[model samples]
Target: MFGDLMGMMGKLKETQAKVEETKKRLDTVLIDEKSNDGLLKITLTANREIKSIEVDDSLLEDKEQLEDYLILTLNKAIEKATNVHESEIAAVAKDGMPNIPGMDMFK
Candidate 1:
């Protein structure tokens, strides 16, 4: 029983290390999204940090329209980043975790 406990502990430690590594990698992931018929573009990291935004000069004439497009584009970029982050975390969990009952919850 003690040996089994030690083995499980070791596996948990290994899994923790993998999760940390995946988090670090996620920081470097970049996702791009566009909206308003491609008039607006946003780039963000998988960690949800906005890197850059591009907008067509034609939208500058209408402040209200520009604001709406900005909000929509930002939301789309954030959604994409979130999906990528979740998938990466799931992959790390699937690869590093042991086949214990209830472990599928992580996936």
Candidate 2:
């Protein structure tokens, strides 16, 4: 029983190490998704917070169209950011063992 407990503790430590590494790597990754016409662009961190935005000078003249495109571009960038962040996190999560019963806590 003691040996098994020691092994589980070791696995927990390994899992903690992996989680820290993932967090560090995620902080440095930048995902930039833009619109087709270059009218709008969004920059996001790996955690999917909007870091910056850019709008073209031409779009400033058209109120209605610019409003529509702004919404579209913002939505698209957000969607892409979510997908990219999820995939990156999933890659890390999948490599580690599932947090289920009878399974290794870290792989």
Candidate 3:
């Protein structure tokens, strides 16, 4: 009936708003990563925006070592951020999803 359709539409709108809010919240969620020896450190938001980088004095002496440290540390930080981002968005989307009859099969 048209009533059910209208209710579903309203629910969808509410869900969308929640999802957007969750995304904004994720901007403050930070993920930190460091090199094995503590020579390099990285911090990024769940949205994958770099927040800071800390490098030890020893790392500056060797360009290649610094590059390697950057590559590894940045990669690890990005991976963690990606995981956080995906899980958060998925949670929001799944929670917001309307329970249509056939949709249960996808779960």
Candidate 4:
């Protein structure tokens, strides 16, 4: 029983290490999205941290258009980032857990 407990603790530690590594990798993962024929571009990390935004000079004169494009582009970037983040977390979870029927549904 003691040996089994120690083995489980070792596995838990390994999983924790993998989770930390995944988090660091997520910080470096970038998702870029554009809107309005590429008039607006936004870059975000897999963690949904906004990294940069690029807007065409032509939209500078139109605040409403700029706002609309910015909103659309930002949403797209966030959505993409969210999908990537979820997939990465799911990968980690699947790696740490035992294989079971319908296990993926939890993710």
Candidate 5:
């Protein structure tokens, strides 16, 4: 019936609004990653914005050590950002299509 179709459409619109809200909230989530040695660290948001970088003073004495730690820390941060981004995207997709199973229909 037409009425039933309209009702489903309204529900879909509500779900879409929820998905948008989730995406907006994700912009506030921050994820941090650091090296095991604690000599280097990076901070990022779910949106993959580089918020900060930290390096230990002792490592400054050795350029190579500093460079290695920086690279490691940067990689870690990127990994963390990627994870957070995936989770946020998943949440939005789930909200948009809770009734559909095994459907990869969103970005």
Candidate 6:
């Protein structure tokens, strides 16, 4: 039992390291989102750090419209990023998990 426990602990540590590495890698993963009319384009890392924002001259003329576009586009990008981040981490964790009974986390 103790041996099994030790093994599980070691596996947990390894999985944690892998998750960390994946998160760092995600920092380089770029997600691009654009407004429905293509007047606003934004790029950001999978870590949700904004990298660039491109706006059309027409959008620049209206502050409220620009804010709305930014909010909508950023939310879409953030949702995509969150999905990727969660899936990657879950995959790494599920792969490294010690097969303990009743712990089908991925299911």
lDDT of 4 by residue, 7-54 (tens): 767776887788889989999999989985988888999999999998
Better of 3 and 5 by TM-score: 3
lDDT of 6 by residue, 5-99 (tens): 99999999998899999999999999999999999999998888899999999998999999999999999999988888888888898898889
Ranked candidates (lDDT, high to low) = 6, 3, 1, 4, 5, 2
Select the stronger candidate by lDDT from 2 and 4: 4
Error of 4 at 15 (Å): 0.9
lDDT of each: 0.88, 0.74, 0.90, 0.85, 0.76, 0.91
**lDDT string, candidate 3, 1-75, tens digits:** 899888888888988998899889999999999999998999999999999999999999999999999999999
Model 3 alpha-carbon miss at residue 27, Å? 1.2
Clash number for candidate 5: 0
Question: Where is the poorest 10-residue window by lDDT in model 3?
Answer: 98-107
**lDDT for model 3:** 0.90
List residue ranges in candidate 1 displaced over 4 A: none
Residue clash pairs of candidate 4: none
**All candidates: CA RMSD (Å):** 1.7, 3.4, 1.7, 2.7, 3.7, 0.9
Clashes (backbone N, CA, C under 3 Å), per candidate, total 0, 0, 0, 0, 0, 0
Off by over 4 Å in 4: 98-107
The most accurate candidate by lDDT is: 6
Candidate 2 stretches with Cα past 4 Å from truth are 98-107
Candidate 1 per-residue lDDT over residues 1-107, each given as its tens digit: 78877888898899889989988988899998999599998899998999999999999999999999998889888988999998988888777777677768765
Clashes of 1: 0
The TM-score values for the models, in the order shown, are 0.86, 0.69, 0.89, 0.83, 0.67, 0.95
| Local lDDT at 30 for model 1 | 92
Cα displacement (angstroms), candidate 5, residue 48, comes to 1.4
